[model samples]
Target: MRILVVGAGEVGSSIASSLSDAHEVVVVDVDPERVESLTYSEDVLAVTGDGTDLDVLREAEVEKADVVIASTDDDETNLATCATVDTVSEAFTIARVEDTNYLDTWREHHGAFGVDFMVCTDLLAAEAIVRVVGLPTARDVDPFAGGSIQMAEFEVPEDSPLAGETVAEADRFDELTFVAVIPEGADHASVPRGDTVIEGNARVVVVGRPVSVREFARALDPESAASEVEDVVIVGGSTTGKLTAEKLVERGVSVRIVEFDEDRARELAELLPSVTVYSHDATDPEFLSREHIKDADVVIATVGSDERSLLAALLAKREGAERTIAVVEQARYVDLFETVGVDVAVNPRRVTAEEITRFTRERRAENVAIIEPGGAEVVEVEVDEDSVLAGRTIQDVMADLPAGVVVGAITRDGQYVTPRGSTVVEAGDHVVAFVQADALEEVTSKL
Candidate 1:
């Protein structure tokens, strides 16, 4: 597929980078210098031009493109670009509109503007990061189809009911389905362990609809209260942190932020009137103690420095906070926090970059993620009527696929089915697979 990405800024560049592996990506920006410094390499075609201009869109061959994404910084310009694309081509157009005002009424406005989808960076980024502050016990959450289904990762606590239960026995919820198990001290990373007994605090992964999943998690340990966290404290004043705090407030949840920078702290105070802001060093144990971090339901550290963030979370956790989460950029320290009892270590750049990725690679990347440990991955693809595996079975598809990659299960209309040897895949079904990173392109052709 050919895609035109407007604005070679951080988000636009990230979006372009994610699609360059599989699609023909064209990047257009107003500033030639910005476009030049931005690297997409020869994998992507870069051009210097105003994204809102008709001539520029025409020159990029917008009509022939499969998707046109307007992700310029200016919201009005993005809307205009989307309108232009809609007028000229039948391609799917996604506008990167950041203003909350437009996003509030997007579902209704999108159809009138011929916008196939609207990328609300703030909304997505907040939903992705907010829970880290509210519920740090969860390692990761994959929300599907506007949150109709949620796949959440939780580690079994030492005193939980799941402590001594086997994988099959531990997952007893009728609604909650056990997806996969990444066992402790396993050399192979993750395994489809069925009869393996779960140790206390074992990383148990599950998938289910929203309310059912929460109930299932609550049943695992009633005292932990891991599933119900209403109070949250954020320790950062960055754009990512502030946006996360704001979204939580909109959901009628109480949130407090401790920012060290006076100027940024004041900005957050004025912008988010509902949230209480404290202008003190979040890393300082003295200030944290004064605020009584022990009573707070959750403590999230996003102080820009991985060391500082991790230290704050550790201090807060020691202070008796229920859960502690940190935003760390360093790859080495990702699992370090969880290992040392600090709940979550999120890579903000990776999270923010993937937001733009969804804009460019919509058809593909039905469930795309940049996995950890050697940058390997598992991607879920949909088998539409036009797909190669439309009328084929799992066995037939496996014969054509390389040995490194393999399909796992079938999701027909949001319902997951364990694929047996004779399981056949019909049209309009989504295929979840565990794939080797380098062979991603090969998986696309077969799907």
Candidate 2:
């Protein structure tokens, strides 16, 4: 497939990098330095020009492209670029916007801007934060099979009993499947073998039913796991923060929001009557103490400034907050935030990139998730009559698949099946597999 990606920013570059391996990718950016950097770093064509210009799109052969993605920072620019692409080509158009209003209008009016798909970065980021809040132990969580199956990543605490146990020894849940073990300081995650020992502080990825996942998480960290969330504190009245608070309030949780701007704080107070909104600096020790942030079950930092959010999260953690989740815009700050004691760091750019890439996947795949950014992916595919996976046993498929690919679970007629070597995959069944990024193409070809 030929794909043209506009704007060469973090999200655009990430999409280009992920697609360049299997498709013909061309990236356009106004910044010459960014274009030069992408050219040297990724296996794709880099064009230097305005993405909304007809001549520039023509130079990149947009008419021959299979998908055109408009990912510029400006909402107007992204919408206009997608409209321009629709005028000159029959390719599918995707636009990335930060406002939820545009998304609602586009969906209600049936592609008002000629965009076939629209991705909202703030909405995606807020949803990511909510998922982490619900599952406190999971560093990241993704649901598949209509929410019946979940893929979650959890870091083994230094004091956990499973820290030094092997995969076969640690896995005691009948409903859970251990897919991969990501050791501390490792560049890549490995598909777990029977003898793969989970070291202390290592990150482990698992897939299973929701109830079973919660049980497994409690088993890993009983002291930190809560049966239900009660008190919650959110810093920042930004769109992402407001969305997070709204979701929590809907779940009947006690919510408090700290906003630096008085006007915004007043607006939030009026909008969310059940939530406590305070116009004060969240980084101030006295302010946090007065608000009883130490007694809160969860602290979320969604401030616009990355530095301020990091500081607020650290302070909340120091004040005895059970879990801290910070919203980070910069991709590089995610690890730094985690290293400094934040329970989870959500990156909007990476989340948006992953959502956009799902639409560009093979037709057989119902959903695709970037389990470990740039490292591994979890794909949910349907077994069709012509698929190589139909009518095959798990043992036969594993022998034919790549080394790092593992069949996590399968659903037949809405019944969840923990796949074993003798399990058979029939047509119309849904199969979820964990695959290394480098082996994605080979794995998809066999499906």
Candidate 3:
């Protein structure tokens, strides 16, 4: 796909970096310094010019672009750029909206202007808080098909009855998808085949019926009753950390935030009097010990710096914090946290990009989320008649499935059906399959 991305701000840079792998990206921005500083292994053509000018877009061949994304910090600039692109091409246009309250009006009013999608980071961050507050036990959650299905992250505790159980051996959840298993020492995640035993210490990632995800989580740890989370300790007090604290407080979760920003600390102490706010560096073992970090059930790091966030998680883990969720913004630092045993990396920019791509993809129906290490996710999509596997059963079609891919569940209408040798996938049926980045093209080839 040819993508014309306007703006070189944080969101735009993240978008260009993420999409450069799979698309022909041409980035335009007024700042020559930012454009010149961008380094990408893949082809990313950067042009220094005002994005609102149609002539500049024409020079970049915006008409040939499959999609145009306007991500300038200024909302009016983005809107104007989107309007100009609409005049040049029928390509899909996405605008980074400023006032989140104007989303409905802009979405409705901009059809003639060719703005197809409105992305607001505030709303994206807020939705992240929503997921955490809604499911406090979940470390990470990916919404799909407009929240109809979710790929949720969790760990298989040592006490879990599923310690040695395999996906094929045990009766799988009816509405749930068994996604990927993140083993202890590998750069990649593996597909969970039935009979693939669940290791006691493995960081298992699952996709299933929302009820099944919860039930499976509870079934793994019988001691964790439905609403049994006692307390949570959050490391760092950045904007994301503050928002997380507010969300957790609203859910009645006893929250403690360890931050280095004294002013922000005082602000939080005043706003959330119930929360214990401490002004201290989380990487400091002494401060962690004084705060009783070892007693918390979950520890999350949302500090701005990746190095500090990883260090904080490591210190918390050494202090006996059970679950350490780390905030990771830079793509290069994913490995750093992985080595440091960080539970999850909340890259909202990547999440937001995937959300925007959902609107541009013409063939995909009701996509929910994208899984990491490239291409692994559980997608519940209707099989239109034009699809390749409309009349095929799972056994006949999935023979060439790659190592990191597997089918988990199939649904016809609202009823969940167990896949088998005789089960035929007809048009209008939805399939939930787990695929790795390497297997994605194959998964789509079979449609």
> After TM-score superposition, what is the CA distance of residue 391 in candidate 3 from its true location, in Å?
5.0
The alpha-carbon RMSD values of the candidates against the true structure, listed in the order shown, are 5.7, 1.0, 4.7
* lDDT of the candidates, in the order given: 0.71, 0.90, 0.72
Clashes of 2: 0
- Model 2, 334-431: lDDT tens digits are 99999989999999999999999989886687888886644588899999988778898989988888888888888889999988889999999999
Compose the digit string of candidate 3's lDDT tens values, residues 249-368: 787788999878899889888977888999988888888887789988778887878888888888998999866777777766765676558765666566666666555443554664
Q: Is candidate 1 or candidate 2 better by TM-score?
A: 2
Question: Clashes in model 1: which pairs?
Answer: 156-201
- Number of the top candidate by TM-score? 2
Full ranking by lDDT: 2, 3, 1
Lowest summed lDDT window (length 10), candidate 2: 366-375
Q: Highest lDDT: which candidate?
A: 2
TM-score, per-candidate, Cα-based: 0.68, 0.98, 0.76
Question: What C-alpha root-mean-square deviation, in Å, does candidate 1 show against the real structure?
Answer: 5.7
lDDT of 1: 0.71
Q: After superposition, how far is residue 331 of candidate 1 from its true place, in Å?
A: 9.8
